[model samples]
Every structure is written in C-alpha cells, then in structure tokens.
Target: MKPLTPRLHGFVDYTACGLMLAAPRLLRLSPQARRASYALAGSYLGVSLLTDYPPALRRMIPFPVHGRIELATFPALLLLASETQGRNRIYFLALAGMVAGAYALTDWKADPDA
Candidate 1:
C-alpha cells in the first residue's frame, strides 16, 4: 500500500517547496544553480498551491496530474545535477531522490467522496 495519504503528501509538497527556495542560500550554490533552484521552487510552489489536495490553495490540477508533473521533474533534476558541480550537484541529486521517494510512496488516487 502507498504510505502517503493526500494530506501527508500535501505536507511534503509544501516542505519540499520551502527547502528548494532556501537551498541556494543554505548550500551556497553556483549562480546558475541558484537561479535554477529559485525557478524550481517557484514552479513547485505553483503546482502545490493548485494541486487537488488538502493543502492546496485551489483544486485545478488533479492529484494524479500533480504526480505526473512530479515524475516529469526527476529527469529535469538529474539534468541539472549533471550540469553542475560540488554542492549544487549533490543538492540536485538529493532533491531528485527525495522527489522520487515521495512519488513512490504517495497515493495518487482521488477520493471517491470528494
């Protein structure tokens, strides 16, 4: 069974968005990586806020669609990692792994009663 309910996944989504926003400063990433991180954080925040989940500001994107977006992000994260060095590479790789883990554990099914 998937370990993450929609509520839990929402919490993870918001948390990850915050981390992505802060990572550039915290990790002292290269300028290119910093820009990428900020852009990623903004996009991630937008997706989380619009996702059809408990913590969303609006319910435009279905939870399953959000999951697909997340799946699509894995490759992008890996590409960023490949182009970077040192802490930036490590951060992207770690973020990619974290996203993959969350995706693997989350339940993408819509609630029948919702």
Candidate 2:
C-alpha cells in the first residue's frame, strides 16, 4: 500500500498527542503509567509543533527527521506496553502500534527541507 502524505501524518500526530494526553485520566491508570502518558503526550505535542509540515504550529524541525523519530519510537512504545498491565494499557498499546505502523508507511521524504 502507498504511504500517507506528510499532511495526513501531521493530522495523525496532533490526534495522537491529544489521545496520549487524555489516556491516563480517562483510563484511570497507575501513578507511574499516568506520568509516562503525560510525558509522552507532551513530547508528541512538542515534536508536532516543531515538525516542518503544513500542520505544524512552529515548523522548526524537518519532516523527514520527524518521521524517522516516529519510526524509532514505536519499538520503545511497544516495549512499554508489553511491560504494563490493564485493559486500558492494552487498548492504548494496540492503537499506538497501529498508528506507528501507519506512520512508518508514510512518505516522509516527500517534503523538501526548504
């Protein structure tokens, strides 16, 4: 299948950030899990803001770099999910995996540095 365009990925990034931010409270997770979720949410938002895409708020970081980061982080997210417990964690992890997988398929190189 063809990869997602940068614009679409930008939308995904923003949505994912919102989901991560809300997950801990919505799922009633443990303190540690909650903290992790918050951290991930903040990080995602920061990255999204810095990404050089049409949807980015600030557009400081290059789009290719953002995609590479996304590709790199998925494994860690998977590991984190595997180490955690509860239905909420499982559901979050599953969605994260699917999103990351979709991100990996995106055409990160489509956008130029300029």
Candidate 3:
C-alpha cells in the first residue's frame, strides 16, 4: 500500500507549492526560469486548493483525478527540465522528482477525508 494518505498528500502539495514559489529567488535563476517557477507555483497552488482533500479550499477535483493529473504532467515536467540549463534545469528536475516521489507514495485509492 502507498504510504501517504490524501490528507498527508495535501500537506505535501502545499509545502511543494511554497518551495516552488520561493525557488527562483532562493536559487538565483535567470529571468525566464524565474517566471516559469512562479507560474508552476501558481498552478500547483491552484491544483492543491481545488483538490478534494482535507486541505483544499474546494472539492472540485477528486483525489484519484489529482493523481491522474500528476501522472499526465510528469512527462511535460521532464520536457521542461530538459529544455532548461544550469540552476533552472536543476530546479525543474528537482520539482519533477518531488512530484514523482509524492505520486508514488500517495495512497490515491483511499477515500479523501480529513
């Protein structure tokens, strides 16, 4: 069985979002990479807030659907990482790895409850 419950995953999502929002500044990335980091942070926050999980602001996205979305986005994240260079590449690759690890650990099959 997967190790993370939906509620735990929600916390992880928020934490990752915060890190993404801070990465550009913390990593001293280029302008383009900074913008991309901000965009990714916003998107991650939106998904977390909309997911049907304990920490969400709304219940629009079911837990399993969230998992599916993550799965679908993984390849795109890899592509984005491949297109970047230096710290930008490292940031994107790290984000992708974080997502992959979270996806693997989350108990997506369990009911989403607080």
Q: State, as a TM-score between 0 and 1, how close model 1 is to the true structure.
A: 0.94
Q: Tens-digit lDDT track for model 1 on 11-92?
A: 8989998998887898888888989988988998999899888788988888889999988999999999999888999999
Worst 10 residues of 2 by lDDT: 105-114
Residue 18's lDDT within candidate 2 is: 83
Report the C-alpha displacement of residue 108, candidate 3, in angstroms. Answer: 0.6
Evaluation by TM-score, superior candidate among 1 and 2: 1
Mark the regions of model 1 whose C-alpha exceeds 4 Å error after superposition. 110-114
Instruction: Give the alpha carbon lDDT tens digit for every residue of 1-114 in model 2.
Output: 446787888888888888777877787878777777778778878988889888888888888788777777677677777878886568558657866777767886785332
- lDDT score at residue 106, model 3, on the 0-100 scale: 89
Can you tell me which runs of candidate 2 are displaced by over 4 Å? 1-3, 112-114
lDDT of 3 at 61: 97
Candidate 3 regions with alpha-carbon error over 4 angstroms: none
Ranked candidates (TM-score, high to low): 1, 3, 2
Model 3 Cα lDDT, one tens digit per residue, 1-114: 888999999999899888878878888988888888788778888988999998999989999998998777678778888998887888888888988999999888898983
For all predicted structures, in order, the TM-scores are: 0.94, 0.83, 0.94
Best by lDDT: 1
